[model samples]
Target chain A: MAVKAGGFKRRSGASSDIPSSSMADIAFLLLIFFMVTTVFRREKKREIDWVSAEATRKIDEKRKNILHLWIDNVGQVWINDQAIADEDIARVVRPIYAQNREIVIAVRGDRDVPYSKINTITKQLQAAGAVRVTFATRLEQRLQRPRR
Target chain B: MPILSRKQRVSDEIPTASMADIAFLLLVFFLTTTVFNEEKGLPIVLPEEKEEQEVSAKNILFLIVQPDGSVTVRRGESEQEQIVAYRQVEGILRQELAANENLIAAIKTDPSAAYRHMINVLDEVKKAGAERISLQMVGE
Candidate 1:
């Protein structure tokens, strides 16, 4: 916040009395700004147990550009938050890819899932022409500084 | 009259000294509760479904993920297709990838194998910088 120069200017060597009384107003303004801009998001029930990948890259694609495939611990497949039969992935993915060919397929599989389930999903994605596939993993982070 | 007016002005002023405190409280709350949904992943291309190409046996690296989270590795050129233990995958793939740039790491696993096994194999392949990966269902 820009303080009013004229109000805080020193007068007759009374520099010790420089005005800081408006700091409270500035703080309140910033508080109100954040309160107005805060977004409250809902929790998704389909959060999978993600494995950590050291080679993973942070995804920068927008929400609209992603098509998600979820594989649960039981190997059940879910698309767009709805559980889908294993064979139905190709059918469901066709129209979505037909609408936008630029969309990237994000495969989120549970840590305990089977390889076949993921293979089927990627196969369906290939059939749908969604060649860009990414597996979601939590990036391994180094929390502590290494002692040299 | 002056004293009464002074008392009235003092009472009229709003005490806003706690504004910074209140703002800090909110900032702390947000800092603690904010869930950063940033996720990361190892990316791969899903090639278009087409007729299987007859790749030379020398250019393939076969990997099998067992149901019990064990991996079996084999060189594509071997006639007998000997399966090695899962733990040695990284070293074998690393040496193979270094030797052949066009080597395809083909992963086939039983349906009963857990997903974790597949990811582990894929991770090692990625670390080895294998140029291509083929994922297919293994028939019983």
Candidate 2:
């Protein structure tokens, strides 16, 4: 009878200590959840030299509200990973602008792209009534000489 | 010899007491290493279609960007144009803006000019704190 009582007390005592064995399982579950829900940029990156500017600012708009318009040196315009014709810009942007009135167009043009190509895009954006625009550029810091 | 035998009698099962610690360490490592690529640019608002306003030429300060990356400054109501490098634009624009608070900085880029030239002039114009800015093609 004493042996039976001792066994019961040992079992109870073992359970009284929190089950830390499952801690790893819970941590793994959270890690898997984050890995599954993480959203990465889906668009294919285009190869083009980015222009740098001293006046570049971090766009304060939300991710969804901003649209990227990439103009390559060959004068190809890409939007949402689709190659778009210059003439059809207004047609493409109009419905999008209608759906979201707060959309901002970010022009990501290659440094060597002709200004004429950019002008055409701006005109198309105007016709579509998507007026708010941003010229995406790298931030340039002026190099100062070290004091002697 | 008996102690050696006793030492071998210890638990043969693998210890997992620090499994949680290892997992948590990995989690913290990934969390600290994840870098978000934030969007950045020079923001400008283009006028809506048919919303163009007619302002007097006296309030306009034209900065013409040629195909060779030369910037020419043409003030309002003055035929005299000043040729300057892109670096000198900020100072000239600052002086003009200070002289007239209502002055507008207009950027005219030639069709053949590289986009960087226009951006450089635009950067200078923005650096000078010009509120009213217009971007136009040279032929237009």
Candidate 3:
């Protein structure tokens, strides 16, 4: 007697045809996304020439409120174009500064101004109760250029 | 009467939702909308201290230093002039302290002025009973 034979076999699993290399592309995309989204803090600034020193240090940005004061090359002292006497500085500043709790006063002394003048002002500010005082300087400006 | 039997079959299917496109869109939106902060400066050399001290709110004062060796105090629209003298800064500072115990003073010195002028201002500020001092570098 001859037995009946099955003509075909049926497959029971799903096909795995998707490419694996696409994972790298997704990873790269995610990396680019994060890099684009990150935020950076801004640098605080003022325009002035400061005396240079060998050492430099970073100051905390949040703790201080800056006030700008200028001395021109021709020996003129100006607080925003208004000339003030050396003695009355405290009275002028007390009211405006009273609103802020912690303030940092920055001095931009002109190289041409007499050293004695700057010293006298610094002393006055200190006596008036300024907790922290800083002198502004430029590094490149401080470098002595040879006279031709 | 005859009853018929029903057979049930289960099928597996793949999902085709794309999240990468949405993520990319969001990233682009944030990149375009975000604002960057600008640098506000001239570099300043601050005085060093071993311990950090807190400045009282009521005691803070402002002093603007001009390119010339003059100091001024602001009192609203009007200004009081030339309060800083080499010898009398201490006395002036003491009087200010008498009015308010928590006196902190700020010095805004011009870039063109001499270093000695700043020192003098600092000396006067110290004499004036300012426990805390701050220096201003840029002019407004």
Candidate 4:
């Protein structure tokens, strides 16, 4: 008996063998997304004005307690409402400062106040045991137009 | 012949290779979404040093110089008044030193305040046993 050898045998498995490539692409995309989404926290320091060319590192805001001081254009040293003598600054600050060890004193001076007064006040705060100090200034307004 | 055909059929099967590509794509996607931080600014003037010196932590304090040239202690919303008198400050600071041996005082002055006024305040703080002194400018 001659076997039929000319007939074709149909393949039993499915025609498509390759898996979907979309899953890999999705994974890679997710990885890139995570990397781009991550944010680094920068150390926060109290803002102060420095006249020197060198810059200091930033400090954390949570650790700092700020003391606000205002200097008038006339060079008068007023602490809140009461006028204080030049010599009495440390004395007044010492007791108040002792209560809180972590304090950042912030100084806001008028543009016209003499530098000498500013120096004097800084010296006194140092004597009173203030560890941190910050300066406050308004950003220079951009010149709009030349005066007509 | 039959065994050879079976082997041929097995060899013709395709392998799945998309997982690696998916992983790489996910990694790239996450990397593109990250954000960075910006630095904040504070207007401060550091004191100049004639010689290289280390400031002791025990002698530093803080002073605030307002636009009006007035001085005060930074105590939260409620500020305390501390004027620029040498004798008065010296005495009070001395008491503070007695209580705490390690005290470093820092002074924050306003740029607008008279330079003379700042110097005077520094003189007083120094007189009170504050060895380590630093100056900072006020930022609005």
The lDDT of each candidate is 0.76, 0.90, 0.55, 0.54
Q: Which segments of model 1 are wrong by more than 4 Å? A: A1-43, A98-101, A139-148, B1-10, B51-54
Candidate 2, residues A32-148, lDDT tens digits: the string is: 776776667878889889999988899998888888999987989998999999999999999989999999999999999999999999999999999999999999888882322
Query: Between 3 and 4, whose lDDT is larger?
Result: 3
Name the best candidate (by lDDT).
2
Native contacts, share recovered per candidate: 0.72, 0.83, 0.17, 0.35
Error of 2 at B26 (Å): 4.3
**Best-fitting candidate, scored by TM-score:** 2
Give model 1's docking category.
medium
lDDT of model 3 at position A86: 69
Q: Report residue B65 deviation for candidate 1 (angstroms).
A: 2.0
lDDT against true structure, model 4: 0.54
Candidate 3 local lDDT, A1-148, one digit each (tens): 5443453455546777675446446755875867766655333333344454322233445533655456655545555456667676665556546866466666666655665466556555555555455555432222573422
Candidate 3 chain B has its poorest 10 consecutive residues by lDDT at B37-46
TM-scores of all predicted structures? 0.76, 0.82, 0.35, 0.33
Share of native interface contacts present in candidate 3: 0.17
Tens-place lDDT per residue, model 4, B1-140, is 36555533456545547566657755665556544322222424334334335655334445665556456653222345566443355456667667766665556667666554454455456556566555667662
User: What digit string (tens of lDDT, one per residue) describes model 3 on residues B1-140?
Assistant: 43455555555653223445555566667677666432232333344333336565455565666656677654222444555543455566677778876666767667666665665566566445466566656443
Ranked by DockQ, the better of candidates 3 and 4 is 4
State the weakest 10-residue window (summed lDDT) of model 4 chain A.
A48-57
Candidate with more favorable, higher TM-score: 1 or 4: 1
Interface RMSD of 1: 2.4
Judged by DockQ, which candidate is best? 1
TM-scores, chain B, all models: 0.80, 0.84, 0.49, 0.46
